[model samples]
Target: MDELLRLDGNAAAGVLGEVFSFEATTAEYACGGCGRAGTLGGAVVYEVREMGVIVRCPGCDNALIRLAHNRNRHVVDLRGTTSFTTG
Candidate 1:
């Protein structure tokens, strides 16, 4: 990925807020690939207008989350993460 195109997970806060009830960006997460734990705001984010947002683990470059909207609903995929927790 280009350095100019890279953005932190905070960039997805707006979209995440639409899907989650709380402040999703502050949620904790673990990467399935590297087992590194961190807050959502620490991950890498790539926003694609056509495909929505993709959040990746900073430690291992593993894709930890994917968010999108379609059919008047929000779509979230967390299969790439080992665990997710929020308080």
Candidate 2:
């Protein structure tokens, strides 16, 4: 779990790309059920062609519903960041 959280966006993208067999970008994900927000860190991959992207939420390991489809793009841009620790 720590390893999953530690993976950077690009690295996570690559892994998701391989899993889903489609190019993917790292996006910030929030749990629709719990409202927990963070970078995706699990292994499940979901591709929504209609949305033109895939979504995975680390909190619930589920797809995130777009709050603002046009305003904040789905991709969670954590370009030059590191780990997000929790207590």
Candidate 3:
């Protein structure tokens, strides 16, 4: 598909907040590749309808977070992140 659709990080904030029990957009995440820390709200988020969401670091463009769904469960991976702070 030549057309690429996307949405801002804030668009997923509500769904993420439901899973985290906090305002996910306000949570700070440190990128493992760049060591830059920023609120998740600032990350670039790409939504893949057939799979899930991919969150990338704003500084180095490294994939910081990924959310996917399997059979009957949802999975979240933060391997690209070194640390995370939730308030």
* Number of the top-ranking candidate, with lDDT as the measure: 1
Deviating ranges (above 4 Å) for candidate 1: 1-5
User: Looking at candidate 1, what is the lDDT of residue 11?
Assistant: 92
Instruction: List residue ranges in candidate 2 displaced over 4 A.
Output: 1-27, 40-44, 47-52, 65-87
> Alpha-carbon error at 75 in model 1, in Å?
1.2
**13-87: candidate 3 lDDT, tens digit per residue:** 855764688898888999999999998988888887766778888889898888876775668899999998995
Model 1 lDDT per residue over 53-84, tens place: 88999999998998877887878999999899
RMSD of 1: 2.5
For each of the candidates, the C-alpha root-mean-square deviation to the true structure, in angstroms, is 2.5, 11.4, 1.8
Candidate 2 is scored at a TM of 0.28
Give me the overall lDDT of model 2.
Answer: 0.39
What TM-score would every model get versus the actual structure?
A: 0.88, 0.28, 0.86
lDDT of 2 at 80: 23
lDDT at 50, model 3: 60
Question: What are the per-residue Cα lDDT tens digits for candidate 2 across 1-87?
Answer: 222232223444643443344444434444654566564444244443333333445555444422112433433332222332321
